[model samples]
Target chain A: MSGPAYTPTDEELAHLQKLSSEFEPEVTGPLVGERQSSSAITTEYANADPVYRVKTAALPSKYSHYRTCRGDGHCGWRAIAFTYFEALLRLGDRNRFLEEETRLRSMGNLLNSIGFQEHLYEDFADECFDLLRKTESLVSAGNDERAAAELLASFNDVGVSMAIITYFKLLTSAWIQTHPNDFAPFLDLGQDIRQYCSTQIEPSVCEIDHVGMSALAEVLVKQAGFALEVLYLDRSAGEEINTYRFDPVSNDGLPLHNPPTLRLLYRPGHYDILYKMEDVQQPAIPQAPLHVALADYADEFVPMPTSRGMSDVMSLIPGMYPTGLGQNWPSVSYDYNPSPIPQPQMAAVPTYTSVPVPTTSQEYVNTAHHNVPLESPVGMSLNPPMTIERGGPFRPSMYELEPGFQSNHSQSLPFQTSIFRNSHYNTAHFLNPDFQPEEWSPDSEYVTGSRSRHKSASQ
Target chain B: MSSSRSQTPTKRLLNELQTYQSDPNDALVELGPVSDNELTHWTAVMKGVPGTAYEGGRWKLDIRIPSNYPNAPPEVKFVTRICHPNVNFKTGEICLDLLKTSWSPAYTITTTLTSIQQLLTSAEPDSPLNVDIAQLFRLGDFVGAEALIRYYTESERWEGRQSV
Candidate 1:
């Protein structure tokens, strides 16, 4: 059957006009934008039809607010793609951010393996990557708000927005082929997977079905570590859209708190962003999981193996490993050697005093490759030669070293510096510019030692 | 396609134009906007394949890209006469899946024209726009089909010059 007749009568047109006038402006730009409180929807339906009344009444508690999209056939894809990029921006961590960029670039291989010609989809992928790189550079320059504004602008820009949407379609198509077993059973028309993708999924204006949504969720969850929650709002006999969460991973496998999970609202033919109204008023992001909310690589705090890795040897011989130096630990010495420390003498050395080793930036670079110099007494003892008492609070003069530390690293490893120059703790500590140099050193040393001790014990 | 029409045709058409210019296809096909200033209306001239019954034939097609463009496939009609199972003899309408429900934004004008060229070489008799021509091709009557196709092309060439 060809379904209903194509013609729309005068009565039907009038009905459509009346219905549209009841709502605000129809979405005309990006898939989703302009967030409004749940009250906006609910209040409009207060004296209206039973269907909208029921739908809006259920929205408040579950979904505090909604961001409407353009309602174009590509709304589902646009909604999800925009949210994905927004989530990455919120993450603020350069390492994970760059890691995601590399992963996204590699997804094109999946498109190639599925017999898709490069010309059809390469430009879209290139455009998407270009925006990501541009946003990353802006973010690295410490213009976070500007980076965010630029991202929003790109979503509305004609060329970049559609390219990103097309890229999403290609991603879904590739996903269908690589994991046919997962989606084949769900195909309703007895259509071959490729035929279904080309006909229903690849084309613009084709609304997402269960298979499309699941395939997208699978790729996102597995490749990008994103956990998505979709709430379906429809004409069913319910007060609200049914909520479905797609985690597919336990907390143990993810970063500290699993990047702030993305929430979206799916109304039969379209998708929109959902927000917890309560989260908006809070101080931007303190309650948010640090891994996603802050941009600094959590590598500084991530504990190393106590027995096998160099961190283990560094733990045993404290003076050799530059602990509490923050991101300044030369990547070569710490990252180069993963094998366990073989020498018994090195392993037997208990933790040494936390002493401030003042060295020129050149000295740090010179000693980066030589482990022998690190073990020498010249490296252990410094200019003032102050000995930090063990098992008690040891505060090294952080205030005095802060100026030198900043200049030293930026000069030695210019390219390695990130927008987040210091670890979160250092940023908070340094906020108090009046923190006396005498008191700051010993206290921070004790805190650093206790933290390392805690890490070793946990391991 | 109509209710949720997107505003992407002109931009997409410009992109396709750039691509065609940067990497011109083999001499078999040529396509561009009907007028330099009007991007929505395009014209394509494609050469028939060498080893086929339609060999040495050149076909002109009027390509109208709706304001909605890629979202709704371009409307293609043969301006030159051709005898094929899947192409309408009366209205010059095409019966190709890429121009119908299988249409994807991924398909450019070049790809669509290429598909039409392929149709000339190999027509699917199962779903034909012209039933009688489809039956002739289906019965494997190459001699009869070739004679009719040649007659149509010859007359089309004669009319083509007169109109010009």
Candidate 2:
């Protein structure tokens, strides 16, 4: 069973002949000026051996099934030993397979019920059938030694590979080594089967590949069918016919094979002979952990009420809490005493202090504290805590004022005109671009956030 | 195991030339059926396997290649009635890798003819080739499949010559 006895067609021989001729003409380098053709790659290949030589040897009575049996040597002890070795290797893991099967069923993954187990049975049966075919041929040739205990050992190899799913590659490789031209074709089929299997099934260290399924799936169905077709055209075994067709690239099995996938080929609730032959060792993933009396952490996670422990927090910002700002960090007004209006607090801690209030309008505190002016809380400054004033003057330069209050406060506070003359303010560009007459007027109208509205109204 | 060959796609098809001298006494390997042909162009037939819904059913296929003989594989299609994942039932295009990607110089028209024959034999109703037949096959009434296969395989024999 190591290799199939094939009779190559005449067309196959001509293909090889064409290959030899294609490379022969350009083999040697020309003496001087011979124009070289672009297809001289074949010329480089000329020195190599001409391939596709058919080996004609009569195996002893052992190969009587194939008409190619020929014997020109001594006793066939070597062939007997090789055959026995193959048998022992094939069936070596039967005990392990049975043990594992029981283990998988105990865990409750019903692999024993699917078509996979039948596949295994089929592999074993096929091995037995092939060995029988070979043994019968040997017995017919009168080589009883080939039919002895040693001759059956070759099946051991088939058994091990079948259990782990390496049978197809081993068979393919044996075919390829003798027929090197078939290497490309073998690899192509191998890879196609691999992708197809790898698609539907996960990669396992020991699982037979998907190609085995492609080959075995059909075989199982046939043996299981046990019936023939009507209006049959013909039946023959001599022709080299491949009854299975699969795609290599586009025929990739479902893409979830390598990913985290659990393909229940069949639903739970059925178990039978077919399931026993399939791969039973699957990575077990449980639905939920068993309920043991473990300590519950829920009681420890109860948060302590720290805000209730504080006594001064309520007095610091006492106010009517704003009804609706719809913000997580909304802030209340800076007014110390309770106001008639329920204040909406700020969304976040202020980045800068509030602008200073004007001497006239009390509504202009510099929330965005800038270094521009000083307007101490009207004699009651001690009641509210504020930015500790930096040493300087009462003018806008002395007190820290926010830029928001710049327009109104700048007009009220006198500029440090003397400090400007001494410093870089002496530069001509730094001088007021529009030098309007500086006038003091209480007549300044109050217009908060609507100077344009007033002007447009007037217009 | 012995699967890949168990199922038989029922359906007989012969190209324009059925006179290739078939030896009836010799066991013949199953191959695809003829769907269409001329003097050189030819189609093949294969029957679906039993126990499956496509059992007793026939499938048609198209097989044509250049005169290069076995140097390149022929393009084979499941033309008659296909209701599996690997074939398009309506257009009769197939998705088997041996046809397109895995084709080698050694392959012949005969090999693909049989492989597709087995494919149609074991029709996976879960993976359908035709949207309509796939639906019908899904309900598990494989009898419909057998009827459809007969229609496609037999009706085409008349349509083929009439259309030409």
The DockQ of each candidate is 0.15, 0.02
Model 2 bad stretches (over 4 Å) = A1-459, B1-40, B48-52, B55-60, B67-71, B78-85, B124-128, B135-164
The alpha-carbon deviation from the true structure for residue B62 of candidate 2, after best TM-score superposition, in angstroms, is 2.5
Instruction: Kindly list the per-residue Cα lDDT of model 2 for residues A1-459, writing each as its tens digit.
Output: 335777667999979886985552232211111112211222332343232010001011001111000121100111222222222222232332233223322322222232123322333234434544555555555554555432323422323213222222222222223334433353454554334333222211112223333333222211111111111011233111112222111112211111111111110111001000001112123211111111221221111122111111221121211111221121222323222222233212223211111111111111112112234445533423222232222233322333223354333333557666445434322455533334444444334225657788899
Candidate 1 stretches with Cα past 4 Å from truth are A1-31, A47-55, A141-144, A237-240, A248-258, A278-459, B1-44, B47-57, B64-75, B84-91, B95-97, B118-164
Chain B TM-scores across candidates:
0.85, 0.54
Categorize the docking of model 2: incorrect
**Model 1 per-residue lDDT tens digits across residues A1-459:** 555877788999979987985654445654456667755666866787676666656555334567777876667777788777776666665565677667777777888898776766766777777777877887778677777778877887655677777778878889998999988988976789988898878876576777887888766544465667787766677443466866533323333223355778776776878764322222243333333212223323231222222322332232232212232322332222322344454445443322223221111111212222122233322322122222222333332323244333222222434443453323333554533222235555676679889999999
What range of 10 consecutive residues in model 1 chain A has the weakest lDDT sum? A359-368
> lDDT per residue, candidate 1, B1-164, as tens digits?
11111355665678789889888866346679878899888987777677777766777889998766665689898988788889998898998988876788778888888888888877888988888878888899878888888777666642333257
